[model samples]
Target: MTASLQGQMMDMPLTVSALLAHAARFYGTVEIVSRRIEGDWHRYTYRECERRAKRLAQALIALGVEPGERVATFAWNGYRHLETYYGTAGFGAVCHTINPRLFPEQIAFIINHAQDRYVLFDITFAPLVDRLAPQCPQVRGWIALTDDAHRPDMRTPVSSYETLLAPHDGAFDWPRIDERSASYLCYTSGTTGHPKGALYTHRSTVLHAYGAALPNALGLSARDVVMPVVPMFHVNAWGIPHAGPLAGAKLVLPGKDLDGRSLYELMEAERVTFSAGVPTVWLGLLAYMKEAGARFSSLERMVIGGSACPPAMLRAFEDDYGVEVIHAWGMTEMSPLGSLVKLTGEERRRPPAEQRKLREKQGRAGFGVEMKIVGDGGRELPWDGVTFGDLHVRGPCVIDRYYRTDTSPLIDGWFPTGDVATLDADGCLHITDRSKDVIKSGGEWISSIDLENIAVAHPAVAEAACIALAHPRWNERPLLVVVKRPDAQVTREELLAFYADKVVKWWIPDDVVFVDELPHTATGKLQKLTLREQWRDHVPPSARGDADCPLTDVSTDLNADHAGCVPPSDRATRSPP
Candidate 1:
């Protein structure tokens, strides 16, 4: 075999600092706007942000932060948090972003697990910091991400973010570090157990930024104005911090105020052209737009992920508001940019309804990402679009294993995504459901996502979550839980009837329950686990030989445990004689 020859080229390491430096030097005048915790809008240029970030790097050094050390940040998406991202990682230390939305115990567990040296936070989280200080003894110091005057008076001695950077003259140089060294640390949401960290390296982070900014993925450019409504603490805000700067797009960060009104105002005030966030955030924005009868002036595109976007929401954005909806899918372990739903020239030539259907899928895998679906016994499934299987992916940006864990989660060099999905002949990825969330009835599978999407398509339904309820004859059946629009009326019979022709007769939900709102995780995903626990013993009206109940009645008979009682209606059609 011939020996592989290496090309003679410059061996400069790809580092996070390089992204910011390039932006500052070339896109110096590009604006980086942020809504501050002080209830005011702050604006700066990439050049100035780079200078302050350099000063922050020097400040960390003075505080005895060494290379490979972990500096934690509990902050919202803003300029200071952006500075923390580059400053800590640029100095060869790991920037650990902690989600403040998690419970106090979970936050303390993560801080201790990471053994973070210093904790920096926005002023909005001062109260939370005080509660967590005693629990996280490894956190050496707490730095408030605010100026001297607005610094919170906490029980523990805290330093001001501005004060720390004031002494440094922004003359420090970013040291050359190995590209494989750890750059960032982010933990999972920990819905099942304690959250595990997914540590990112400099090489992988840089490659992810490049791939995400590609023409097919985010398609970011210097002319675009980008706002990431996704929290900075969540998967690095879907990697916008790095990709936006790499594309030289102007950034607008909405700090701490993610409500519909605040986000709409910010988007209008700044003339944001492109934005990214989970479906829940966009739902709130859509609701507000309907109430105020407003339309977007400058917004052009929106990237929706974190959960399956209801078909109705997709139509609302593209058809009603004239904004392109880019449905995306990924996990925390994949550097969170696996696949994006964008139509091709061939696909776009079809009718609008057909194009919408293509966009309904998760789209094709992004560059550098390879994906496949496997059935039972590890057998690879064919891309026929009808068969569903476990979705797995492998890529340069994907994690080899979790941080601090000895065992690798990869199967045959590919990471199992824990999603049941299908791929069409054209290689479009369609996520059907989470592996744990798929409902099995009489040895047949039903996609909860499909049911939920159809349920939310009803005009009166605001949000809907379909969960598997314990059943006697069928093993388990889907029970629809819905939240209705304010002042809108919808009955249980009406909703169940609405699903008549949309899906298979057997796939329709057995019963419906109205709730004030469905519970969501910190990252804006529907909490199906919580819903299952809440309705573990719920008896469907079908099983009780009763007609469909009222939607306004929020009561359920938890003591009805008759699993052997098969309704005559179900037996006549579905049961074997």
Candidate 2:
């Protein structure tokens, strides 16, 4: 028997630099629009961006930055910041996008941990650098992403961004660094201990970008004008920085001003066709549009992630503005593009009500991402769509370990996403709640996300958060904290009654508390941990469901020790919360 010979093919490496080079070569004339901090649109071409990127790369080399050395950037989404991304990673240096929203101490710690040699930031963050520079002694120089006239006077000697690049003609050839070399570093927003870094390689980034460009994912193309309202500091703005160029999509970068009016103006002016951001930003846009009685003339799709997209927001975008809403789910560890909610042909043919139900889910896993649910016994759960389990993901882009940490977070080669979810037989993923945020009542698990989503759907409620509060008998019960719409009056009884018709009696919150606004993290996720701490001593108003409650139709015998029963306090800590 003769062995079959493998087909000879070009061994082109999948690297970010290659992605940019391909764009510059094929789509050089494609427009790249950016809203500058000066409240003006800064326009350029992919060719110009690529040339400037090379110039910036040369500038990095001139600054004594070596290959594999970390260069940190604390800037908003704009042309200069985008250039920094390409320049740093395209030239084989690690681009660590530090989240300026983090505490000063955290910024210092991350910069020091990454051993960043140069810190480049926007003019807005000059004050921040001035305050944190004293602590980050490892950073040799500070490069401001501004002109000489706009540069802030700081204690540390600062370099002008344009001046640094003036010497380079962008004629230098890009080196072929190993595809496995470190390219990007992003730190998880640590809820427990200190933030842990996730180091990504060029291969993983390129692969993730490819995944993001797939039609089932971001649906990027050369004709699309893409805008990412998500901060560049967060998961490379959900990998749009690379995916845009890979697909040759015209890119639009919204700078520091991310409010509804500002975003709408930029989107209208740039004629952006696709955009991605958290649900909160979209909510703001919705509010602004409603007030002005305007519609998105060009936007075709909006991707909502960072947190679950409210059903109302999804409906508002589609029903009111004729824009399709794509709900996405991901974390910093998975090159941040895990699953996007896109309907199949068969699903799309269904009735609007049925389709909306499917849209509420986080959607099916992307091509490269594999997802499974695991039980407490370390066994894989069935994809029945009803049984919830710990969501575990394995993919080419998923993180195997934290940067600089010896501990491996993988369990049997699968990275636990810390999310409790269910996967249907059709492979659609429904994220019920985060593992830590799941509220345990008696022996049953009540999904906080489900409750919050339901509560926010109320017209009077602007936002809502469900946190587990200490209970004497049930051990822990859900407390619904709501922020009412302006001038809206909603009684506690009214809200509880509203839930009675939707969820089971056991799943409803014991009481409702109104606040001016619920707290949110830097990335716009509901900070349930802080809420849990703030309402630690909360007292439930009652346990028994109301007589008119919809749950009265179901079995309610508490003595049966059912999963929904409010058991005594002894079994409170029996299992992980």
Candidate 3:
């Protein structure tokens, strides 16, 4: 074969610093509004952000931070956190973002594991820092993301963020570095074991920003005012810190106060045109709006991910309020921008019902991403939309291996997503359930996500989780656990009967249990593992020889004890029937 001729083009490496530079030069006047931890709104321009970021870089350098060293940040979504993102990575240091919501042990484990040189945190985490200071001995300094007046007194000595930057005159120039060098480090939620880190390169991060800002992906532009309700510590806030600035869109960072009222008021005040967050955040906003009989004044679209967006919530946004809802799905390893659900020209021409059905899926892969489903024995599955299998993906922005791990988790070049999913003929991705979370009953597969979505569609149901219970005949059967809306009553008989027409008879849950609340991970995903442990020994009515009990009697039994006929206290020492 003849050698192909290379095109003549500039070979400047893509870096995160370049993105901030472009924003400062072109979108200088664009506003970046943030809610401060001191209960006030802070606003600044991209030019000013660039100056402060440069000062931060100078401060880090003067403090003896070297290239590729880890600089950890424990902060909320705010201007200081944003400055840290640009300054640390811009100066060729790896910006390690630690989730504050993690357990104290996990937090310490992360800090020590990263061998973080310096720790920067918000004032809200002062007490946590004091508690963890003794555990993370390698940390050279702790800087509070606040001024001297707002700084809290802690057991450990801490420096002020603003005070540190005060010495630098913002004259430092960013050093050009290889784009393949590590720029950011984020750990998984560590639901199973110690959270492993995903180290991202500057090249991959810049590419991810381009893909995320694509018209078919997030569709970001300078005309849009964007707000990321997702914390900056989580997968780079799904890469909005990079993508939003790349698009030159005005940004609004809602710190700490993620409740419905605060979000609504902020959105209105800033005229936020676009936003992205997990479904739980939207649930609160929707509930608050319903109570206040409010409507959006400028908000136009929302991107929902982190977990499946319930059909009910989607309809409530689009039908009740005229806002478009985009369903998204991804993993930390993929830079968290894999698939987004947006209608195509042909899809838009379809019936409303058909469009809604298609929108319920996770949607198609963004540019640079390739996905497929595989079955047992490592065989690739077809995109027939009906055959669910293990989902795997590979792309330019995807992680090849986890940080500090010896073995590669990739199988034949694709990263197994640990999710059971399907791809339709048009290449749309449909997530059924996490591979570990899928239910197996009598050798048949059942999707707990489907059950939970349908349950939440009920007006009286606030949130739902379907967990597998030990069964004598089937080995495992599903039990629906629900939390009711305030002042809303739902009987087990009514809820069970409501599922009759919506799903296959066998797919329906065997029993219903109401609880005051369900557990969630730090990122707001359902804690199914915790739920399973809580209900591991639960006996469905069928297994208890009480399948024929009257519906009213079963309702009374469930109401009397949230654990069904047998309360959890009684089942502690008992075995499955």
Candidate 4:
């Protein structure tokens, strides 16, 4: 094959509309399986999925959900979720994925904000639906994604999802919408503030789906039994839902439960080879693997992201089970994929210990993505490993603006990711910390991650979390919270001094508290926002810029001196929100 032919647009497809058509026409028998509502296996094929999706398109049009109108889905990963994806977009209506994890108030606000006309939610969220129904006025239609056999008593005027399509002829010509037509919308994780919607175009979604299935991306195929543990309401389920069918992979849906036992059962029964989820999910899987002495006979990979995976967890997967952990990093803005950590052939041949270090760092940027590190002055930094700066990215899938936000902070054509990172000489991305999570003292930024990592190195710590608190003198200072191991005892001075050989003395946290446990989000990363809120009310006399003034709101006192203060028992070596 010539180079010209390889990159040529000729003889190639233009959009996801083509992908679905091809999957239905040529790869019709490919299975798209889901867990049954009656607690058994449900089996179907791509041809049926496509036919139903088209019928759904016809139904949307019949109901007068106009082109460019939004239809929301509050669902788990299942065949119906897959149907809505193609069905909504096929009709030129945007599929707005409303995360069930969001607060009920936030859910109502988003439904109102997005002006979603219909909601197709899984039976699992029935109670939350009942509670929020009275407030969500824009949702004129409510449909439960369940069969008559599994239907629960619902307070709303609901229809069975299957029944919604039962009478339709199961055929509709997809609209010839522009590739740039909006396809799907996913709101950001709302912990920091109100959720802002990110609208993805058909062009962007199709390109991302293609890129994600490449040899290095997820290496998917019709042969690989794929199950994405990531939630569909978040970042297109890490873009797996579309990628799987596009690659002709036998997609498996782990509806509702993601606990270790359920995952193992699904993987073993389905012979699932490729899987993806955040680190916390893997930790649960790892615990189950050990406790049950379970091992997969056909599994190959475990893609981890949303937060950094610890070296220990990474080690356990590769060393014990022969499963590769691909540590990926990105934000909601970057189609949620910027850097994926997988070693090049040359690096893989190195000593196992040496390779571990490289695998732990975020991998090189993917084919279509470009990355840069910029200092606080917004000056682009060198790619040399030593220079650390904010991570900015640009790509076909990366969003230029949040659809719901009035003022977008994305700068100069690049999305300003709040992460502090470095592009090493080898092109690997090393995440140091979040820009706000780093402590700046005497005009120098100290990585809370580096401090926390060094603290966890001491065997006495079960988990260590680091945060910056207000200092009277230094603009910001470090705080370390540690949950000690049952038989181990560690103190503030001892832990601070432990970093003596590793990091600069001034960089260590001033206080170390032993907390009984740490707070975490539903997604499993340490809840720094909750921690910041709790201590946001605290101020010491020395660090108080206002001098003995009480801190009613630490967020308002951003300019306060953080010269002296430290963290209490934290959950990990790195807890960047």
TM-score of decoy 1: 0.95
Runs in model 3 lying further than 4 Å from the true structure: 548-577
Candidate lDDT values, in order: 0.89, 0.87, 0.90, 0.79
Residue 436 shift from truth in candidate 2, angstroms: 0.6
Task: Give lDDT tens digits, candidate 2, residues 208-287.
Answer: 99999999999999989999999999999999999999999999898998889999998998899999999888888888
lDDT of 3 by residue, 1-577 (tens): 9999998999899999999999999999999999999999899999999999999999999999999999999999999999999999999999999999899999999999999999999998999999999999999999999999998999999999999999899998888899999999999999889999999999999999999999998999999999999899999999999999999999999999999999999999999999999999999999999999999999999999999999999999999999999899998999889999989998999999999999899999999999988876777777877777888999988999998989999999999999989888999999999888887665466789999999999999999999898877666678999999999999998998888899756667889999999999988999999999999878777677676422224433433433343345533221111
- Show model 1 residue runs off by greater than 4 Å: 547-577
Per-prediction tally of clashes: 0, 0, 0, 16
- Give the candidate number with the greatest lDDT: 3
Provide the RMSD of all predictions against the true structure, rounded to 1 decimal. 5.2, 3.3, 6.5, 6.8
Candidates ranked by lDDT, best first?
Answer: 3, 1, 2, 4
- Write the residue-wise lDDT of candidate 1 on 1-577 in tens digits: 9999999999999999999999999999999999999998899999999999999999999999999999999999999999999999998999999999998999999999999999999988889998999998888899999999999888988999999999999997889999999999999999889998999999999999998998889999999999999999999999999999999999999998988999999999999999999988998999999999999999999899989888999999999999999999998998888999888888889998899998888999988899888875677877877667889999988999999999999999999989989888888999998989998765467789999999999999999999998877567788999999999999988998998788755677889999998988878889999999998889976567565532113224222222123344333222111
The TM-score measured for candidate 2 stands at 0.95
**lDDT at 207 for candidate 2?**
95
Better of 2 and 4 by lDDT: 2
